[model samples]
Target: MKNIYLLFGICLAAFLLNMALIKLAVDLPEFFTSHLNDLLCMPIVLSICLFIIRSFSRNKGIKISLFSACSLAALYSIYFELYLPDNSTRYTSDVIDVILYFSGAITFWLVQGMEAGRKSSAIKKAA
Candidate 1:
């Protein structure tokens, strides 16, 4: 859907901009540098995944369920926050990051639903 692609583009652009700011040493707020990526990660990743699933299944009307989204957030939290921190020094455990991941997932679900609703309404109006 156009809305999904637009949301994905905006989130991806924000993530890239955040990374660029960090790389350029822009000295922004701590949240922008540290937590923004975590917040945007799921929406960006999940949108792409959903698009691929829709394309392959030939079902543009399909949407990711809330349970699936939250489950993914939980899995990411467990692996990246709980498991990786213990196994690798590159990762650190952060409870806030877990919250952000869920927040992003919910955001994706809300946007997806909005798009679906609009499509249904348009169909109804045409009929």
Candidate 2:
């Protein structure tokens, strides 16, 4: 079903965005690296979750998926922190990441609801 595609998309976008952010970190100065991660994490995760939700269903499914995405992001963050060879370990633990996780989750849920509402109304009109 489309929901399956949504899940896959969530995973893929997260992977790619994280990769890109990693690359950006290398180019950024130490001063910018920490704050940049903070500002960037939520929008990237939320964007993916919202896109997936908009592409699929409008029900609680979207909310559940958004929450799942947040969990996955957190796990991925922890894994990368402990496993990945990088100087950014300190940046990962910054409280900003935690806030980003929740902000991203909530933003996605709201975006999904709004988009789903639009789709539902459109479908009703066509019917």
Candidate 3:
């Protein structure tokens, strides 16, 4: 639960920072404005999903497995990139957005694994 909270807090801070940058008319690169933040969306949403699942289950803060995380990420990417873009006037259809979403998901997966490894090593050291 502590790790989950830390991960969620970090993601939320990042998401909020990005949104603030956009809202404040900060002079960011066009890519940052258009695509880079999209790259952060997966970790943000994935962490939230993990937090919700762990909060309800009595599993002592077990993170979602890589397969489950990837599946959910893909589902979200599809919804945002394909369905939403096609259906919503606000969201323009862009192939790059899909790629960015996957990149973010992959990054989150790697980070999650790394965090687990660190914790395992630390526990071993303590023992």
Best by TM-score, which number? 1
Clashing pairs in 2: none
Q: Report lDDT per candidate.
A: 0.93, 0.56, 0.75
lDDT of 2 at 26: 58
Tens digit per residue, CA lDDT, model 1, 57-96: 9676889999999999999999999999999999999999
What are the per-residue Cα lDDT tens digits for candidate 3 across 13-100? 8778878999999998888788866777777788777767777899854766778766776787788777997898988767787787
lDDT of 2 by residue, 11-106 (tens): 456556656876776574553444444434554555555557756766544444566757866765665544453555443445555565566555
CA deviation > 4 Å runs, candidate 1: none
**How would the candidate models be sorted by TM-score, starting from the highest?**
1, 3, 2
Sliding window of 10 residues with minimal summed lDDT for model 2? 31-40
- lDDT accuracy of residue 31 in candidate 3: 88
TM-score of 1: 0.95
Every model's TM-score: 0.95, 0.46, 0.78
